[model samples]
Target: MRPSDRVTLEDVARAAGVSRATASRVVRGDTGVTAKKTKAVQAAVASLGYIPNSAARALVSRRTGTVAVVIPEPDQMIFSDPFLTQTVQEISRDLDEADIQLVMVFGDQSGHGRRAAKYLRNGSVDGAIVISHHRFSGQVEAIMSVQIPVVFIGRPVAQASPNSWVDLDNVSAGRLAAERLLECGARRPAIITGSLDMVAAHDRLRGFREVLGRVGIDPVLLEGAFTAESGRAAGEALAPRIESGEIDGVFASSDLMALAALEAWRDRGLRVPDDVRLVSCDNGPEAAAANPPLTSVDNPTDILGRAATDMLRAILDETWDGQPVLVPARLLVRQSC
Candidate 1:
């Protein structure tokens, strides 16, 4: 047949000597058709070059077969952050298997919550999966008000009541990081935390502090954005204290910051794990590939993404009862600590 000649299900049904309904069932892999008839329909479909109209089928099914993934950050940041990249890839894979389309929406950090709210209210997609909820500005309320299913990647700070979220056990991750450093016999451990306004960072810090306090060690705390630049600045700021022998160990809340601290230590000609033991969060590839490697906390981002997608799917399917899912974190030991 010519490339311009389009094939339809009806043509396949005629060639297979079966009703169009039976041909469709065969094509869709629906059960109940006899094996012989199914094989005949399949052969006819192959010979006729029959291609199902997915869009038309969706229209008839009242399902767009699409899910919206909302990221509250600039495109550049999204691409730079390994955690976000892993989460997105996992979510996309899960959605692909379910035959659902993933529509990505990038929102401005400043006033992103309101913008996200407005975007969802417009009803452009079936449901939404929200990431980076720290920048959320009443967006949760807006999302909940939309009467559409929404699942959050991390714990939302603004909302006092726990909403449906898929997150790592950041508090336990923090405790583990501190414990690992202490087990190495490093004293006077200090922590450089991500934005405390976010619950993940806060919980991690709280956990670290609790463990350190139990051991009678009070850690010096500093706050920084989750970026290499901020990590560098944090390193410089903490240099004097390290030199004065007041700080012997350090824990960075993110891998980016940990890398910066490692560089800062190198620049000052200080021996890692000897002079200042360091541990970081997020065991991304970069963390494992860093010079001397980094002792880091490993959060299952792929699993978290899958869980988030499942939660959103449940809500959309009206099978969820609004429960938060918490995934665990593991500690990976390496040369840095």
Candidate 2:
């Protein structure tokens, strides 16, 4: 090739010893190429500095070159919840690297989900990544009818056969948090759960229950909406039990909830770890900086966001495995417990 001439896919194919069609497929992010051929094509593309034409790729793939991220909550919730905010930011960053636009859509109960669903079905985007897919919601029902490739950020309750997803291992996190609280001398423990509608809340409660069952004791269940406000309310409601010594330990489903509850308990003149031991999940930055560092489980929302975006790409490429991906969870020890 001349020095001034742009490197072509043809040159890449020849250098990689693969057919022109194979080279094109690899350049466009298709995973159907054999492992050996893929590696060869990658090496050739890098060495030759071959830039895949985005326009040409769109023509070949018959795609709009954009993807939608459907969130099943109102705008306020997404902005207020750090976990959701971080997840969206990570997904946007990952998609931006590939020249893909991330469209945010709300699918809450406010009748906006129907409009979002209509927009999704209109073929405006190449595919979709849904977050917090609540069951029986209008948005879910409408979006489920779309024929394009779709993936979920978390394990959906209504994931039909072949629905792609990525989620944190909440059950193990719950178990770890429960064990830590018990080890710290928590006898009459309670578990503050997230929204029961989401599968995460159930999984956490299940894991916590497993640990409590070992001692033949039942856990006190407090339902929250994975929000600090909900956590505060749950904490304030526990004034009676906390003061009466009915509940001495607590495992809140999310760090946001745990932190808010801690404040409320303190307002009620209760001391953390001294009055009642506490544990939480999602070892986000806030957890470490709390008045007393939180003993929590590490459920990195950024990791979940990136994995979910990757899953959507695989689906669009028609090379996705049918298996769901579960990011592992572990415990982070600190002063609270």
Candidate 3:
């Protein structure tokens, strides 16, 4: 074919010795095509330099071959948290494997949520994966109001969730942290938790409290923003209690917070596991970098990301049966405990 001439699907079908429908099905990634015919179609596409015009294909398929990754958090929070970065990267890679484009949107802050909701409602993408949405943010309400297929990366914070979601077993993770603290002989334990607006945070705190109560330990609770600074503040608040022998163990809901607590203890000349044992969630690099290496719970953010992407794909494919995916978490013991 001349450089000025466009190679159409029918041209490729003729070159591959297959019908146009068979070629179209292969290009659309539909299954049930024989391996020999599929190979021929691919070879013909390569030789003919055939390109599927996405705009034309969308007209017939009603799919844009694009999806939105909506992060309902401030830009600073997204950049500061490694879990968020890891999850986004995984989701992007998974979507890439499916030959789909990712359109990222920061939904929190100012009128971002409203604009994103409007864009999605306009059928700009086939579906969306919303992450870290809060109940009061009005973002979840906006997304749910749209007609697009949606999947959440965390437990939906809205009162009435209409879509499937993928989340870690946060309650179980909290219990695991609690058990690790107790096993290390931490009698008076305190918990530093993430924001309560998030269902994940609430579930983690609830699980931690339940397990501590079973052992007759009334844990001290501290609200944290899942930031290093918040962890430092919580640590400073507990310093006096640590000296008074009122608090001997700590469970920071996030690895960053746990590391901050470690630094705070170090500043007070307290030895880890000797004076206070600590455990946290999210087995991130910060956990491994602690002076004594903090023992932490594995949050499995990567798995959650892939699961969310898969769920969204299923929804768009019309094969979803309205079931949510719940990934599990585990504990990683280290010297801090």
lDDT of each: 0.85, 0.85, 0.87
Residue pairs with clashing backbones, model 2: none
Q: What would the per-residue lDDT of candidate 2 be over residues 1-337, giving only the tens digit for each residue?
A: 7879999999999999999999988887666899999999999999999988877767766888899989878677889887888888899999998789988887756673577778888878988888876655444556767888777876776444345778888888788988998899888998889998787888889888998799887988889989999999999988679899998999999999999999999889998888888899988899999989998898887788888888888777766786788989889999999
Runs off by more than 4 Å, candidate 2: 1-56, 110-113, 137-141, 159-162
Query: For candidate 1, which ten residues in a row score worst on lDDT?
Result: 135-144
* lDDT-superior candidate, 1 or 3: 3
Q: Whole-model lDDT, candidate 3? A: 0.87
lDDT of 3 at 70: 90
Q: Please provide, for model 3 over 1-337, each residue's C-alpha lDDT reduced to its tens digit, 9 standing for 90 to 100.
A: 6789989999989999999999999988899999999999999999888899888989998998999999878788889888888888899999999999999888854663787788888878899998887767676778888888889988886668765998888999999989998899889999999988888889999999999898788899999988889999999899889888999999999988888877888899888888888898999887887788889889887789888888898888888888888778789999989
10 residues in a row with least lDDT, candidate 3: 107-116
Clashes of each: 0, 0, 0
Give the clash count for model 1: 0
- Model 3 misplacement above 4 A: 109-112
Best by TM-score: 3
lDDT of 1 by residue, 262-283 (tens): 8987899877877888999999
